[model samples]
Target: MDSSSPASASPPPATAETGRHAYRPKLRWQPDVEEYFAAAYGRDRFALISEALAHPSCYSCIRVNTLKSSTDAVMHKLMDIVSENGLSVGINGLDIGDQNSGSNTHEGNSMVHKCPYTGLENVIFVRGSGPHVLQYDSQPEQSVKEVIVSRKCAESVLRGAQVYVPGVLACSAHVERGDKVAVSVAVEQAVEDGGWAVDAHYEERKGLYIGQGITAMSRAGIFHVPHGIAVEMTERVYQLPSFNGTDILYAESFAS
Candidate 1:
């Protein structure tokens, strides 16, 4: 979808706090499970691992189908895509081979590197930089266009996936196609009824900012469609080079 200024008279921002860091759910484990892990790894180390699980991978790995195309060809194609998108590219961990030479690719802010290990020539890595600062543009008079998504949806979006219609929890009123919108995930809390309830209000404290995108459908269309992309993300707070809307994914069996 194309990107444009958000429509006026949109809903005010949510209760979620504004920041570059992703809003992640706290991990809860059974008493025995926590004890086992804490005993194996120190409590501090175990905590670190748990925290990391809440975030996306720092790098994306793509495995090329050697039967369909060579690694060099895919590398060149990926570099071109990243460069055209105005993201920097760099070659990393390339094994010595005429076809996989670093000089063959252009350089920029983002990085694309070959698998460093042997026997993994078909695999490539695209480095993702993240937690970059984002401005939600929230103000008292001027409202920011927003789309609230499920916790699961936000997790995927942070890891380079697009916002699908089914994952959308709410959309600001008057959000039309091509409008720029801030995306956040609804925080879930357990209720006395034993069911879960999400913080639906678009408050910085209620949800967390994942990134921004251009809507492919209007507020109504998003709910009308059973399944499809609702938002084409332009910026992810945790940046992973995405090949959505491009043939790069189909042409290669990318599994990252």
Candidate 2:
């Protein structure tokens, strides 16, 4: 017998005792606001507004930073790590290799490096270049410090950053010298919901995901000391390694 047949499809009807219903509380809106929304969007404006108000507004984008490391090198390293662990990895478009391939540059100094370990190759290097820092211009008079990472970038270090604590914010919560944390950014998106008004233009974009880091300060003493790497990155999306082992060179440079 076919299951789709009308005779075979017959099932017991739901009894009153088996039926379920949910009660929703009634909501009231101001008459003036309702009139304004009606004039602005016509029919079904309320539903549209309700949907707009509830949707997530933030989007994610990664930055390509050549100063710390080439995209190829980072991609190769990550592939090697992943492959050695017997896991498969894939990016938008790139093949995996089985051996460490020497660095190959594409388009001038910007080259792609390949690894021989996992049979994977050509993963792009992405970093959290602070949103506030504009792209560098050819002008020589520009301050190099202007291109340094932003505070928002430092916060992202909890996701992955080196053990340097000087990058922590001045007013952070109770974080110690060696605690793990997940970092996130607050982003604003424009909504057409007549539910609430937002100043889209005035909203600033200053968040970047830096990665995880180790804390360098005590939770209680952080406010008093106010200076140090509050969190050190461990694993970051952008594979910029923190040069934490250069004590001699750093001391000599400062001494001079």
Candidate 3:
């Protein structure tokens, strides 16, 4: 979705082109904005760009400052930390071997976590899960309270950002600080370009499911506070699987 324009209120002013090949991808972009882009850079290009933006980064890249510590040293420390964190030696172990075929351990039951790259003395690489299907209403036991954040926050959340105080547009009633809440995005379909208005109540179809988080601020604090973390996102809806270890980074230390 193009974040540069207002909510899509109407379709573009018709086009001279016709046919199925006409780049009219079902992107969440405002029709007018989509038309503008389609006008500027053909329809096909516009569709491609829209699709690319929605997907998160495929690989999690890490640049290590070798001056402070060697790559091997860091790897050993990371292995220990993950092991101590209950990854386990034989169960939830890190896949530092073949990227395509590693220990198939599901951390969240849906994700196949692993560290695919095994080289680069100064850097480490991890593979992440992708454009996988995001199950929104998977857990019914979670809190019913919800919060709607701005489109800005939605984009950031896709790139691993927590909901901040200023980004929050609305919240449910009886919400309190430190409460586990389901966080969604206030995605505007074809509303006017004036402003976004939402009541301080929960809507079943409020917005897109980004993930769940713990509220750092209460119902009042969100609108009252100017800045700070409003929700600390814990479980993401669309998670990019994390891959770290020799399996990804082919370093000398990793080889015998």
Q: What lDDT tens digits, residue by residue, belong to model 2 across residues 145-179?
A: 11112333333332223423233232224445565
TM-score, cand. 2 vs. native: 0.29
**Cα lDDT computed for each candidate against the true fold:** 0.67, 0.32, 0.51
Model 1 misplaced regions, further than 4 Å: 1-25, 89-102, 105-110, 138-140, 191-207, 245-256
- Cα lDDT for residue 252, model 1? 35
What local lDDT does model 1 show for residue 216?
Answer: 93
lDDT of 2 at 21: 12
TM-score for candidate 1, residues paired by index: 0.74
Greater-lDDT candidate between 1 and 3: 1
Residue-wise lDDT of candidate 1 within 86-138, one digit each (tens)?
45533343322333453445222237778778998777777666666666664
Residues 1-256, candidate 3: write the lDDT tens digits. Answer: 1123222121111112222111111346667988898999898987788877655564444555566766556555544444443333332443433222553333211122333456644564433343333333445454356666666676666554567776776676777899877666554443388655533232323334567778997887776656778887776754432222334333222101
**By lDDT, highest first, what's the ranking?**
1, 3, 2
Error at 181, model 1, angstroms: 1.8
Among these predictions, the greatest lDDT belongs to: 1
